[model samples]
Target: MSAPLRVLIVDDERLARERLKDLLAEAGDMQLVGECRNGNEAIAAIDAERPDLVLLDVQMPGPDGFGVLRALPPESPPAVIFVTAHRDFAVQAFEANALDYLLKPFDRERFRQSLARARDRRKALASPLDTELLARLEALTRRPPHEPERYVTRLVARVGWRMRFLQVEDIDYLTAEGNYVSVQVGKQSHLTRETLSALEAKLDPKQFLRAHRSFIVRLDRIEEVEPLPPGEYVFVLRDGTRLTSGRSYRAQVQRALELPT
Candidate 1:
């Protein structure tokens, strides 16, 4: 019969990787070629193993799922089934493109269906990098210079296996934590995998202020600003959270607050 379909699993989470491995074992006529923990590893494995199909996670420590796909060779790239915890606009894009994706915490029946689709796609030798799909994905990731910038009204926060959309207006502050940002909304704080500067770019300048190298605070949330020595100041928020300004941000903070320089 036909040769066993070679597959690679790429995900940062150990549990996720294990789950995929278990499911792949049940998927007859498929051989698990390798497993990669991050995007960089996934790229290396994809290049080395040349697997027929890949199960790639959307978010990880290094380049995300889209980044990995972008790095692949244009001609005859491996078929992909995205594994994502997000139910955002990207999901709609995937659907529009007729691409297969496994939403987080998916059941066995869904997994089987997605795998069957991948098998059919492989048999048909369908090129995964369709021009329209790539264009749509690029559009989702970036905006054309001619297009007016549209700031995000909501941010997706992953809680366990579920995703929740947090209104940007409800965010009181954001702080950098390695590769992730801690979004503070009143007493609740949700962690999302986004750089502080990247998130800053999406925020309205009039509503948010970069108070420190690691902190961005909502302008309206500042209840008090206590002056400190040598151009430093401690800001108290409506939620009673206090954040000290970084030395380099002092001037900007002053201008934002219209305080005497």
Candidate 2:
């Protein structure tokens, strides 16, 4: 018979650690080697225990999950299944790289699925931290926790004969114009050859809001909001530009405005 997989659970919350311990106990083929409450402890535990798999939380004091991975030796890093509450771009990056990630509040079935995938990879002797994954972890670790994840502070726009750099804070709103996006600043509009959705991904969600399929307005620039029927609304900007919210973005708009849903 194959040996049981040794597992380490690393999370700041005691309840989260306990929950993982309970689940690990239910898996007969898995053995709980240790539990860590923070990133520093996790890093030390990883070195001391040398577990086969780590169920890691992203955010914690000192070094984060990314940091713990970063501290590991490049060769033969343990298999990882990130378990965190963050639903940020990093999660998407992890998915794109074909890494296992279990979002917080995951069900027992979901946990089983993630663990099974990890076991399969281990059996196959696949290297968990590849060049690309290491590069992504390096980038994520460099970002300041207070600032939004790699959000743009400025954007390049073409102005006839010259290239202009526009501060994101100065822009009032953005609207899609066919294959291009129009950056509206007061009365002047600068056209940039980029899709609205693509541009929106780089902007901070706290500062910019997608009001419709064709429009993205600065949250602070919104002077007033007029409610419309069927969970829709008309947002009046500081420059007197009125943009209607899309039906599909109702829940997001409500959350941004702190309105009763």
Candidate 3:
């Protein structure tokens, strides 16, 4: 009979480590050689235990999972399956040729799938470690992929001592007051700590527009754009809110609203 696959669990959370340990125990073909709470300990444990597979967490206090990978000598690094909560790291993890990227709150079937991949790699390759892949992984760790600018999908707001989550799509407009902006979603309004310019930059330009210096209205919510005097215009919302456009932002607003210049 083939020997059991040696495995190591590395995570910052004690409960997370314990949970993985229990799951590993259920995998009859795998053996838990060691466990590490943080990246520093993970490095030491990897060298000492020489585990065949590492279930590594990406985020940690010091020397993250990537750091452990960087510190390892090229001789024979163990196969890695990155365990992370954030989905943003998925692409890079797979690009590094990881056994699998297991997102947190995963089921037993998911865990087994990652374990099977690790076992398959161990049997297929002469050396479980791929030095070239490690090198590429290190490079990626140093200069991680740049996260593209993303619009706000949801906004957390305070309502009479209770907190409420406001969906961006549900918002009709925003009114700037000093350093704070009142997010108007339908009939209700909620305030958030943000500047108009800062909030504008974070919103989808196609969906929203700076209708006025103090007002930002959802383009789809505009009932009509009423031409005021001398190049200025007032945007009438579907819900009957009228907001005037700023002189400096006239061209962009007109273009966005498909108004004739």
lDDT on C-alpha atoms for all candidate structures = 0.76, 0.77, 0.76
State the lDDT of candidate 3 residue by residue for 1-261, as single tens digits. Answer: 678889999999989999999999998899999888888999999999988899999999779877787677534567789998988877555433366899998999999999987776555443322457544433332223465646666665545434466778899888764556678876556656557788898788999998667778899998988887777888777866666677888799778978888
Considering summed lDDT, which 10 consecutive residues are worst modelled in model 2? 89-98
TM-score of every candidate relative to the true structure:
0.47, 0.47, 0.48
Candidate 1 residue runs with Cα over 4 Å from true position: 92-98, 126-261
lDDT of 2 by residue, 145-173 (tens): 67656887767565553446678889988
Best by TM-score: 3
Model 1 TM-score is 0.47
| Residue 23 displacement (Å), model 2 | 0.6
lDDT of 3 at 25: 90
**C-alpha lDDT (0 to 100) for residue 202 of candidate 1:** 83
